[model samples]
Target: MKLISGGRRVAGNDESTTPRTTGTKEGTPSFALPRGVTLLFAIAGGTAVANVYFAQPLLVTLGRDFAISPATLGAVVTLTQLGYGLGLFFIVPLGDLVDRRRLIVMQLLLLAAALTVVGTATIAALLLAGMAAVGLLAVVTQTLVAFAASLAPPAQRGRVVGLVTSGVVTGILLARTVSGLLADLAGWRSVYLTSVALTCALALALHHVLPPRDTAAPSMNYGQLLRSTLTLFAQERLLRLRALLALLIFAAFSTLWSCVALPLSAPPLSLSHTAIGAFGLVGAAGALAATAAGRLNDRGLSQRTTGIGLALLVASWLPLTFARQSLWALAVGVIVLDLAVQAVHVTNQSLIYTLRPDAGSRLIGGYMVFYSLGSALGAIASTALYAVAGWGAVCALGAAISCLALLLWAGTRRRTPASAAAD
Candidate 1:
């Protein structure tokens, strides 16, 4: 770890507590959002998520329409995922220094424009650009997470994150189902159009339903904020550990999602698009289970909870390896995978939020950088491996990654002094 002004490192906690101006005056609760803030957070998180995944179910149609090859078609998903990663690292810090609500609304507008452009684009290049734009704007999900963390009393942060995290999972699974259904009946363009409507509604709901400002006044410089993010990775062992775990879990998660299309829609399964998409529902149900589990974290159950969740995630992939013969097996795998992911994800955020309450935006952003990179790697690896070997290769690869993640968490035996610090 490199030294900064603080000698060893500046605590990320500093960033979490720092407030942004322009949203409201000090002592004015910048995000003093309304009583229904929880609902607002869920909607915001869900809406942003829908934008990021709108392309997942449509990749097939996109390839067909644009005459792009599979390797190149994967680029659409790859680039979009990359764009989201970039936003988390770059755009997310602004939430710590600027007005989060304002940033969210602006991002939504930009995302809406990106969707419209994507829906209208005639050329592959233009469509890719539009996809990137949408990906960039989709980082609004991080902002909403930060917002929820900030508003909740410290003790309840886990529950709030768990709830919003559920929205994200729902978006991930539902995007596939909705897009697949709409693309068949209406056209690929209709998917983006539906996103536009959701964005517009979310923007309105946020403005009307969110509370007044509550953030601490901002004083941190851009240099300080950047340094703060890096310092968190350097000084915080648990943050790094949890983040790595997330990367591994999500890699397997993304790998399975990205490759499932090949076996299910082709070869022995020969399933229809709608049928394939419907499988997402099973996964969504898993996410729902994980969300409910989040409530247990604050009750001295975080570690135990995460342990169970990771185990579930590891178990979830088993049925998938042999799932081609039976759709039921595939659905069971989907549920397990989703539950495992959401459980780990919710627990990860719950812990990270406590690390730096002030810089919720920056912290969430930093966390997501790793998450996005992991997802991208998984997606790329899944498709590339499928091309070279087959779904078995991808499944084996995913299983190995999942087991490694489990080992990483299971083997770690140290704990920081912070947990015992004053509650």
Candidate 2:
């Protein structure tokens, strides 16, 4: 497919067409992004994305501290994810319209400020508002992903994406563990304060390290750019299918994490926040699958990978259902579930990036809208489900969602061309 950028057709499929300004002057040197720089981008992506998840393990504590019920505390995660979904639709498309380096830096600074607001919030309303801002600005993770994709060669795109996605997964898993430990020692507020410092430091480092480039500024206004994403969504069947998979898989993924804390914090388990957070370490094993998934996609196995991942997602709920009886069961389920989620995620991104290399930000942003929505649905529903019907309902909800994803994959897999299927 011909890649379009700024309403003009580019000759090749590679997305790294941003005109380099590094060697335009005497005594200047042109430098491709080294592995080290790419690794930094990965780290930055992880740190930025972690902000949205730090509250998961601390839900019970926050509920008590804020004098709210578990059902009401669900809004904290739901609103943050909701804001992120909105930002994916409204803000992320700007990456194609302006200087990405400037965009990322500015977003990071704003995220740091939002983190401070969350850290210092004394009332529930203030905390929820801050959380919304934090999620809104956290789209820097998408910006960095687009930046990394634009820097890598086509042959290495999947590998680079895999590595960066690994960082994202690591950030997500570790955020729970780290937040629990910090909150145990100093209180929940300290978690956000620590994030504020780290985010600011990373933002400063990125400003100096990112390379300079020029590109044709987009001719369309902001409204036109937003409208075009819908047009692109309508035009690309692969985009629609992959986004549906993201929505379903992520909904299942979120359902577990959202309510897992409640059961662990109560009854026979009676786990501490720190202990609950340790479960995230088990999930970290899934990060290993992300690298493998990327390599598999590079070898044209995305369809096969999706089928396996969906199967794993469905099976994971079985082990998770025994959480009250056996911690080991919960741990095993967490590992399998995370592996399945990341595998599907990496494959989906690899496929979408191929469809429109030039619109990496918009494509990723658009795709993640489904991700955010799924997460919000899961976050909001899991708590209420657990409160009303207990963990049984949560597991059933997760399994049903996984089954829907598998069915969607089966129905569409036959019609998707082999080339587009990458199988």
Candidate 3:
């Protein structure tokens, strides 16, 4: 249960005993990560992730432009997601094997090109290809995350990660809203074109501000680096537990988000699309509030944060069950659910980063693969369950998933030493 690094537990006390470096060969950072630099990383990560979600609101418009059927248009998002999943395993590991600053800049430039392709595509297949490319490069967000963790002092890694991750959550929650607004003002193509410009600007900014890795790269081939990423699950018990937690928590998170609109649109409420989209803003507020979880993790309270967040996640369903009866109830549930999910999510990343600072990229990339799977599972299951049963069944399913995560954490805690679990 202990991650023994140099004959002691690699928890809470790492900053005091271990060198303040992520890589054994990599020299220390040139300077402390400035708040402005941290904000840049956050905004960059958020913008990169937003590309994946932009198509969600533009599918109908895209279909009209390409003269494609509704069912066929879903492939735009699906292909993009599939590309993202592939990049986690194949592309993200490169962060450990190369110069991360250069890698991030390269990916950003490529993402801009991909956006351009999407903006100018005249054929359905071409658009799908462009979207896939966008997804592939969007994983620059993960690379930025790993890079940020590497640059931070060991003591402050959790806090920096929390802030950057909050940006990612904000981008996710707001992409559809922004996309819809832009599409309305200009056109569907303008959505991608605007991202192209933003992405190019971010690339230039990051290229200037990102610190160079002063250490030697990992001495492994590309294939070995990837194999090691897979073997990490076998080698590190904490990684395994945290990955499973990611899967469960995000399933619960996505369960609420993927289908909440159905009930809102069909019910006696009959809320407009804009009204349903406004809920994302409420969720973003909750996510932003949970940024404190990272600070608590810096205090070696990750285990405590996860426990409370999961409990709140389960309880949030109570208000959500009354969503049909009250808009106030729905909004409250959305806030609580998003807050709980982000709190635990930040805790998971904070703890996992401690396991392998040198392999931060591989660790986070592997962890997020589970996150993506859980989201897909929840999105599919929630819509199907809502169709067959009702919103109540969907809530039941979400509560069950949250309860399962709680039970898993409880079991893990009982077996793990407090020092190690808290680490």
Model 1: CA > 4 A from native: 1-35, 416-423
Tell me the TM-score of each prediction against the true structure. 0.89, 0.92, 0.86
Q: Report the CA-based lDDT of candidate 2 relative to the real structure.
A: 0.85
Note the residue pairs that clash in candidate 3: 26-215
Better of 1 and 2 by TM-score: 2
Model 3 worst lDDT window (10 residues): 1-10
The sequence of per-residue lDDT tens digits that candidate 2 reaches over residues 237-354 is: 9999999999999999889987899999998888888899999889998788888898888888889998999999999999999999999999999999999999999989888977
Instruction: Give the best candidate by TM-score.
Output: 2
- Local distance difference test values of all predictions, in order: 0.76, 0.85, 0.81
lDDT score at residue 224, model 1, on the 0-100 scale:
85
TM-score for model 2? 0.92
Task: Give the higher-TM-score candidate: 1 or 3.
Answer: 1
Residue 356 accuracy (lDDT) in model 1: 67
